[model samples]
Target: MAQDADDAVDCGMTVGLYGRLRPYPWTGGEGGADDGGEELRERLVNLALSRAEAYDWYAPAGLRMRGGRSAHPVPDRWFLCDQGGADWTVGEDETGPARELLWMRADLPRRIASARLPLLPMTRTASDALHRAGDFRLAALRAHLPLHVTAGEADGDWEDMRDWFSLAAPAPTVTVRCAVAVSGEETTPPAWRSGGTAAEVGAVWQTLLGEAVTVAPGAPPATSAAGGGVRYRPYLEPARPVAAYRCRVREWTADAAVWLLETAGEALRRTGHRVPVELTAALA
Candidate 1:
């Protein structure tokens, strides 16, 4: 297994830890022009951009893979791409083979049940319907903004216009959590199979809720001409936005138990932006 140091070398780990590990820190305060959530978001954007530049696959194709890569360099653009579509499998029940669209560790169901988090069983088709309906309804609420784009291409100009943003009638927020024991084995859930074994599958949960933070034209501070904003707007399909709050691992073993939080103290201290709340939903 890769140690924390080794994992830190991976592209995903770096993107995920970007702003949260900076020296200046973002502690949610009032000071020079470099304090607050806007700065925090900008810091994250810069870090992500650097990583994206380093990795070739992380461009348009990687962005499109699995509905675009998470922790993208351009915050607004990544946000739009993610919020653009709810990609799902259609008519899989009758003809398509049983698929693992979004599989959680088997044990996760029980843990979440005990923790008392809301959950909804989702199929790919069902998730897509929710995504489509949600986007359509949200656009209608603010029809003046022209947020909706053509089927194939994105709404280029209006993509960064935050003035026309609106919330959904029924915003669904599904959070999934699962625990799996690590073993040195090849057989396990795909997510864990590569580096470790799934000794045990723990409880999992999924639910929907309303309330999210979105970027706007003037809301988030503007970027300098040095970093092109070409990547700061929605350029994908099925715009569905989801936020992440917290994701960590708790290891329980014979000798000791440990809880590893995924944030760097320096980053949070500098920006004053408490880590974002864990906000995520399944695409079914």
Candidate 2:
């Protein structure tokens, strides 16, 4: 299940913490199953509240705590998160006996995003391999891709930096502008592509951009698309035109190129475009 969650993260899917609560068995204890439902519900609610409190520092702005029975009839799944304005009460499931079982969920993306960080999905296997090989620098580099870090901040000490990276908190205010071209023609970037279909690419882009991307018909020349021509600039809104932003982008791009070559070499090679070694190195 943890691996499944990690895979979802790697695939850029939003995941939430989930758990189930049920009444204690009626083994002639102090409180029987019939009477224990409400107690169990309270305990579960308290547990959720405690977790929310513990993670409060990482919670997103405008976060509101909520709990309640789901409206759906089949397989009731309740949801709770550190963010959003949905407030629900602890109630009984519709299909089954009142308050027999309950479920709760808490989203992770909200907390991460609230900290102004990018979601760089990684698999457990890859993480484990990097740890075993003691490639902490590369691991840290890949972990915070599209985000720049100072030399003394995160790169100096891997052991201490690991904890900071794990929390994904206090991230630098930086935005990633991806320029991807495939098959020597102007097409969607690799990050947005799943099976190279227009619909799939557009959907992914829309999800990331929070708006539809305008795609012009007809293909441009190969010379124009030689090195991932400027498709679109996906940047953070309310951006300031400061020199620090440019420097951070230059640093991040150099590191990202190296990381992609080292980690996603095969994937990049399959795209049929020559790797921009000069471009990546020029920034360095």
Candidate 3:
């Protein structure tokens, strides 16, 4: 179960504190059962909110990409990260009931006062209600997420994800900037991996990006088929594989990605790309 959630994490958001909760718990070698219904949903959601409160930051990359950001044609999976630790997969087989969960972030006081730092959860009914009938703050939190977009599924324990927002339609004559498929050895990173402060992650991301730009200073031969760009596969623990994020949110991820791709790859010897660059150092 935890392994499955790990796979989903690489589908979008890369490193940091991330988690996924199944409606019901799972038994050994068996899939998740929806033994609990709305009552269970309420329990799980409450757990998620508590978890969100513990983290100081939340990245909405996938929430926007899938929910409609054209640059990210391949929609990223739903995930929440606090910029420390590995992915948090909640289930009977994994971390049992959110109560017993151990996270990478330290329990500290809020650093940003008078700021909307917590990622609150909003019910589907509430979001669709007449005039979003609920706390006014929910409207503000909508920009970020934890948008309670849970839905029923036959495979309850599996990576059951639903859209948090309805995406807008794209123009008929639209142009795609890039398309990619990440294929490599995928595995769940240990809890101790990349357990650094958000600042540490930022510094590493920026430094590596600077070097990557120098390595591939020239542009690749133009291609309408859509190819070329650095890919980062973060190894949370020493030489351990943290899944590649399926998100293309741009900006926040750009520099961090370069760092994980080149520097982390060489150091860990665990990252690679579908497109070969040895023939040429690389191209921007």
Candidate 4:
């Protein structure tokens, strides 16, 4: 009985920490940026380190390997390729062949999850600039500006143009909690728990409500941009101006809320914005 209980605990611990470790995207060629490669690499490193700290903080006490060691061990010294070189190659030596030696522990997954990378702060100056740029973009859009105009043509003003671009923005995220009742007792039926999948839950709930229910995946939390702020090119067609413009705007605004939130959050992080626990809870 004791051995069975220990096995269960071990399984739980492994399940809890399995996906918590990951390599930084920039560690490989797939994560290279078009511009500002150096800056992006630095941010990626910082983000990885920050996520590591977060993982440690939120890590379960029982999360350990069979030998009571940490499931993910951090190295004493790490290496980051700062010479615009390819990914680090495995070698026997401590320095290996990597260019820059980062004298920090390598805990990539934790760092990525921690989101400890700094962002360009949205200062008074920067905020004013963004507002001005947004106004300019709005004017250009109204004037049927050509899509080729690359200056300040990004979709950063979705918040300011919510009313103008109502069709583009997605509906606010709504979390609903409910209990199933059978006669006087509340209980979930076997069908609902067959696979314990969201599809089953939705089907069961729709049957109970006697109406079709839309089951869409939740918008995942946004992450900071590796190179620059979240920017998307504008799609404009002057021939069918309203129809074409509206279609593009709708697509842009559909994901704007979440993207904007992430962009603002990253900026705030760079500016050292800290939220109080009580306030965060209240807002949530």
TM-score against native, each model: 0.19, 0.21, 0.18, 0.19
Winner by lDDT? 2
Ten-residue segment with the worst summed lDDT in candidate 1?
136-145
Candidate number of the best TM-score: 2
Each model's lDDT: 0.19, 0.24, 0.23, 0.22
lDDT of 2 by residue, 109-189 (tens): 311222112122211222222223221111111111221110112222223323332343334423332222322122433
Q: Which stretches of candidate 1 lie over 4 Å from their true place?
A: 1-36, 60-284
Give me the runs in candidate 2 sitting further than 4 Å from their true place.
Answer: 1-33, 58-284
Could you arrange the candidates by TM-score from highest to lowest?
2, 4, 1, 3
Give the C-alpha miss distance for residue 172 in model 3, angstroms: 46
Give residue 118's error in model 4 in angstroms: 23
- lDDT (tens digit, per residue) of candidate 3 on 1-284: 24322123222112111123332233121232233333333433344434434442333333333334222211222234332211123344553222211121111112111111121221221122211211111100001111112112222211111111112122222111211112233332232132432234334333333322212112222221122232222222123222211222222121222222333222121121211111111122
Could you give candidate 4's per-residue lDDT for residues 1-284 as a string of tens digits? 24332222111000000000112344442223344444444543454334434433332122335466334322211111111111222222323222211112111222122232111111111112222221111101001111111122223342333444344335543322111111111133332233323334334323222211122222211211111111211111111100000011123211222222222223222233222100000001
Question: Which ranking of candidates, highest lDDT first?
Answer: 2, 3, 4, 1
For each candidate, how many residue pairs have backbone atoms clashing (under 3 Å)? 45, 1, 4, 9
Question: For model 1, how does the per-residue alpha-carbon lDDT over 1-284 read when each residue is reduced to its tens digit?
Answer: 43332112111000110000111323331232343534433443344334433442123222222244322222112111111211112231223222211111101111111211111111111222222222111100000011111012212312221121223222433222211111112223232333211111111111011022211111111211011111112211212222122222121111000111111111111222122111111111
RMSD of 1: 23.7
Off by over 4 Å in 3: 1-34, 54-206, 209-284
Which pairs clash in model 2?
A: 67-88
What local lDDT does model 2 show for residue 9?
Answer: 18
Cα lDDT of model 4 overall? 0.22
lDDT for position 268 in model 3 = 20
